[model samples]
Target: MANRTSRDVLLRGLWVLGQGIREQPGLFTVGVGGSVVFGLLTIASAYVVGAIVGEVVVPSIESGRVETGLLGAGAAALLAVSVVKVVGIFGRRLGAGFMQYRLQASYRRRVTRRYLDLPMSWHQRHPTGTLLSNANSDVEATWFPVAPLPFAVGTVVMLVTAIAALFATDWVLALVGLAVFPALFALNVVYSRRMAPRQVRAQQLRAEVSGIAHESFDGALVVKTMGREAQETARFAGRAVELRDALISVGRLRGLFDPLLETLPSLGTLAVLLVGAARLRQGAVSVADLVSVAFLFTVLAFPVRAIGWVLAELPRSVAGWDRVRHVLTATGEMPYGDTELPAAATPASLVFDRVWFSYRPPVGEPAAPATADQSVDPTAVGVPGANTALPPVLRDVSFTVPAGRTVALVGPTGAGKSTIAALAARLVDPTAGRVVLDDVELPRLTAGSLARTVSLVAQVPFAFDDTVRANVTLDRPGLTDEVAWSALRLAEADGFVAALDDGLDTVVGERGTTLSGGQRQRLTLARALAGQPRLLVLDDATSAVDPRVEAAILAALRNSEIATSILIVAYRRATIALADEVVYLDQGRVVDHGTHQELLARCPGYNDLVTAYEQAEAERERTRSGTGTGDSGGGDPGGGPARAAEVVA
Candidate 1:
């Protein structure tokens, strides 16, 4: 079974290689044609050396008279061969180089498109580092053989030509030289078998190392805050060391193979010399024929080595190509909808219809997509971690917010609040039910339409290393200062924008490192606002802001001239108070949902969670007071919490 799988992988690589050849036949022809020219050049060089020795040098020595014309003729023939050889070299190198270039570029585009097309579940199953490697290192390795493929063809031509020349000069020594090729082939097959597994391991380790580095860099703030820099460094170093060790193992095997490849040709030459001496004594071959036969072996040496080069790289290319194919063939891609939202307007109304969803930690390749039977109940899922067979995050959940209204999602830390928000935005489809917007299921809307109509702003905002205006506009055309200023004002982000050195043109560092947490969050919100989306989904978008600023922002959102429907994940009283209705959740189910006062009067769980928030706020306030850094204006402090709780009770 293992052998069959290996053979299948090799066959797939060959198939892909053939496809590449077909795509760039002209380039392949250039490389092969060059090799053929070089083969002719090889035969000519050998023949010239033979003619010089047999027709000129030997006669000159015996007759003690130099023939100027013969020497000139030999030199001119050699010079002409040298010129043709240069063109051959150009053709071989340029053709192979261009072929490799096209292969890398083409595969990179396909892998990237695959990444973009795959759904959230697929992205979740695969690591960011692995995906990055798939589009880069793995792709490069998969096409590594292209550089040698045409050269190998040339080597074959050289081999056939060398064999004919050997026999034409003297059939006796030709047989001796032929023995070397089979030995080299046998040695290479054994070498590839020993080398392949290590190359696969090395390729995998490289991805691991890349992932570790990316994760470490992404969480640099956490590592710094927790003072785990040394630990992170040690972790990175460990993976790097493993990758280094795996490469060394590959190199060691190649080291052993190289010396053998170099040694065999010399052995073949020695055999030819011994046989030629015996044949010359027996009057079977002339000195000119013997010299030409020996010369042929010397030229054959490189072609043999070139053949080894291609065979040596085969295992790695196959291993890498297999990984690339795995990603390209991964299932669970969301079947996108062709229904474009009417260009006139998007009637945004978000609803959850008997919705159920569950997520499992990815185990390995070929992971199954979430299905109804496999869905875990959120109540039983416990806290999401490595536990695979967990419950659903949302169960039998159904609700809706009419256009131009705000609906707040209130829940405990793990009560599926974020999942509900994700559904509203169609980031992931529901496992059992549907999330409809404007009377159309989100899955039925084209991606472009969905993006235009719905916008989901994450809590922790991401900003590119670009100007604030560019970040706000997100490089969308037709967004002028008027539109940008309007959105910034709505997000309450204009105050900071005006303070920046370059105003809207000021550059925000990578991931908005130059901005404060609150500033980044506001800009993220502003970016969404600038899009003028009909349906706005905020997943704790204002959690990082001071309560005062948050209140001001929410007031702008509520009273703003925009008719956008807002579905925001909220915990603070100020944010919730801004909502027209509140949906209270306990565990993963909606316990009760109504006006804040109505829910406070009836739902015990809703009241308790709000009360918990109140006490947590008071405790934080006292800590701030003790630290002599209390800022009452930033947040409501504990004033609303106690009063709100009294109304609830």
Candidate 2:
């Protein structure tokens, strides 16, 4: 059984190589043709040397006189063969390198494109670190064997031709050639079998180590702030040590077999010489024949090792191919239709018709019942399923934001608010029912149509390491500086932006680290606004800004000339009151919907939730004012009587 498994692995590795050859047949042909030229010349060089020794040198020495012309011809033949051999080596190396790099680059693009095509739910099930590994190191490993593949193939031709030459000269020497070659092949097969599992283990460990390191670095702030740097370092080091040991195991196996592979060819040359001497005495072969065969074996040592080089790399190639195939063949790609929405400058109305959604359990995990109020764990987002065992996060929820109006989604933490926002933006599809925009189902519209019509600003702002103009415009065509400035003004971010050293040209650093939290939030909001989206979903996007700034930004968006419908996941009473209407949610169900005053008067849940939020806001204001460190005149420190009246009326 073990032998069968080893054979299967070897065959699979060969299959991967075959796929590569088929994919780039032109380059493979060019590489192999050059190698074959080198091989044939190698055989010719051996014969030429043998001929020179038997004909020119031996005869000149026997006669006790130098033949200058014949010596010069022999020298010219050797030099000419050497020149052609160099040309062949250059072509072989060039072709092999181009083929390998091109294949790696192509597959990396394909993997990255696949990542973009997969839905948010699919991305949630995978780690960013693992995805990066799959695109980079794994793709590199899959094509690693291509470097030596041509040389190995050429060596096979050389082996066959040399064996025939041996038999043509002397059948007894042919028998020696046959024995040494088979032993060499057998040793390589054994080495590959022993090396495969170790190579595969090492490849897997590389990805794990990358994942741990990325996590540790990505959360560096958390690690430092929580004083868990030592724990994080230990976690990273533990995986790094495993990867180190795995690579060492691979190296040890290669180290053991390399010398052995080298020794087989030397032994073959020894056997040829021993057998040739006996043949010379028996008159079974001429001196020239014996010399040629012996010289062939000596030169064959390095070329024969080419085969071992290829076989040794096969395990790693197979491992990388398997990993790449996982991404290429992954299920749950979100499909889009060709339908396009009609172009309109007016706001697009959004509606949820009995929409229900539940997070599926990850593969092989039995789902446990959980409340809608329970927080989502980032690591456990699951694969798609037809039905989930856990309770739905949103159950028969229905609401609408009419065109040219603002609707506030008022819910306690984790009442599926963000999920609803995602649904509205078509970042995800509801498991049951549908979300419609402008009277069209989201899935039926083309991706471009959906993108043009709606934009989502996530709760946590993200910015690329780029100029302010680039971050706001996102390189989208036609979003000139004028448009970016307008959006920044609408988001209440233009003042600080104008004060920057280079204005819009200044680099923001990674994830906008050079900017304050409020500044980053405002910048991201401006980015969304610059898209000129008809329906905008803010998943508590302005939480980092001062409450007064947040309220002013909302008011500007509500009164903007461009006309957009807004769905905001809001917590502050002031922001909620700014909405044209409020949807009160409790435990994933819509408890009520009405104007702020109507809900405050009629619904106890709404009243209690708003009162708690008001108290929290008042406490934060008191702390800020007492410390004398708050933004000057930012919010009403006494929880403004006018806003309270608006809520109470």
Candidate 3:
């Protein structure tokens, strides 16, 4: 981003202030009105000094009399001035509080809404720390301008009013005080130029700190297991130190600017006093007029100081507003079709037509074989790249899940099985292909229509920090006990849920940490089953379940009325044997596809892979039985029996 000039910062700050008022006009009007009254009262207090001297002190000295009536009336008038001063103070504080509160509340909500509306690809580029800071600190910074804006405006009004009164008493003194105006504005511009880029850097560093902290916390388990606590802490501390330095730089500049604003009004008053003394000696000005002019300049100091406050915050406010606007106006929004999916009268038959897809690397990451621009459709009318070095994840892959038939996708790691499942669920769009469900293209279906038509249960599932029931329902309207219980039973989670202390209402810790790995997996499966989507997808969703238990769950799914077609990403024989057909994928291509037994007989690659998987499973079974029987020295102290089994495989 280009460095913002002083004028640009001030203009953007003003725009943010105007936007706040537009959002809450009534509150803004009340706040500004109060500040104006407050400003007038502050100036009036200065006038009372001249009033007391001119009206009571002058006459008493001339007459050489203790005039009780005159003295008593002056005291009464002073009391009235005090009362107005108190009211003005209250109004100014009230207005500033109101506007600040409204601005913070409105922007926080807007930032959250924008995050939800942004596409997943955009989210992939931005970290949790950036989004969190945008919602919290950036929002607060955007509203900081609101705190000083109204008071600053009122001060300007009071200064204009005080000057008119000053000139009415004596022209020369008023003119001397007016010189401070341009000088004060000049000070503000200089401060903005020095702080604008620094404040922007400061805000970015704050997000960096937040991101590092969040990463450390999120990966706490991994760090703990790897015994890398010092490494993680050092990573976080590095960013924290940088953020501290940035904030100090901005603070140092502010320190210099604020005092100068404060001292100028005092300097103007001194200038007026020198001129007024000479004018009084010439008998050209009365003591009362000279006193009034000097007092007015002293009163003007407050507003001048407030103007400094507004200017000091402008650069940070501009930086924050720019970040917020970037989010609101972000491009790459996933455009969905207007058409809804056809009603459930037709079977949900899924097909991938000569499909091709690939992923582009994020900024600063090593470039992937396929660049983003190279993600152009291979099927485009005039383009050609049916075979590029950047092999499409699902290169010219085509398959069909006939109505009511289950298909199992068996493949080595990175064979694009999960990618294919994502396409079927419409979580992502294919770069050069059409994924159709029930004869309708996947992209043509509205979000809601696609959601009900198919449901995907990811390999690693997430549970909200809420009750088990809420996690499944997502608090969706119209979810009933029967529906939830049936899904749980099919997922083989009913037994464990019934055994829990609080049943369905029990609160699950973040990511269901309170639950065992297999238990969390089952709960995730139950969540998808609860919705009873027409087409269900499982991407290694049951990998953690016990083999015997997994068999029961697969049996229940095969016999269930809810899903007509199921797309399973599987490696286990029990799972693949249950499928009506199998698709064998090797290095992203579908090598051969048939029933489990047919593939084992005909496809050499499929047989070897499955045999390897079977041998591995057999080793795991032997290790578990040996551990139970107190063999192998009653299990190794390293705490993972699977490591030994993996070595054997």
Report lDDT (CA) for all predictions. 0.79, 0.85, 0.77
Native-vs-model 3 lDDT? 0.77
Better of 2 and 3 by TM-score: 2
Encode model 3's per-residue lDDT on 1-649: one tens digit a residue. 2434666777877887788878777766666677788778777767777777777788789988767887887788778877876676677677778879877887888888888777665676678888888888888888887877778888788878877876777777777767877788788778877888888889888878988888788766567666789999898888888889999998898888788888888898888889999999988788777777778778777777777787778878888888888788877666677678665643478998988775544434654465564453547334232333244677678999998888999999889999898888877676677898888897777888887778899977678889989877776667787788898999988887887779999897888767765677788998887877778889988776667788889998878777558899998888889999999997667889889999999999899988898887777778677766222211122324343233222
Off by over 4 Å in 3: 1-4, 57-79, 338-347, 363-377, 380-391, 613-649
Model 3: weakest 10-residue lDDT segment is 630-639
lDDT for each residue of candidate 1 in 103-203, tens digit (9 for 90 to 100): 89998999999988888766876778888988999999988888877777887878777777778777777788678877877786666667667878898
Q: CA lDDT of 126 in candidate 2? A: 72
Model 2 CA lDDT for position 131: 85
Error of 2 at 102 (Å): 1.3
**What's the candidate order when arranged by decreasing TM-score?**
2, 1, 3
Off by over 4 Å in 2: 59-65, 362-384, 388-391, 598-649
Q: Can you tell me which runs of candidate 1 are displaced by over 4 Å?
A: 1-12, 338-347, 363-390, 614-649
Winner on TM-score between 1 and 3 is: 1
Clashing pairs in 3: none
- The number of residue pairs in model 3 that clash at the backbone is 0
- Cand. 1 Cα-lDDT: 0.79
Clashing pairs in 1: 376-391, 376-392, 377-391, 377-392, 378-392, 381-391
Query: Which has the greatest lDDT?
Result: 2
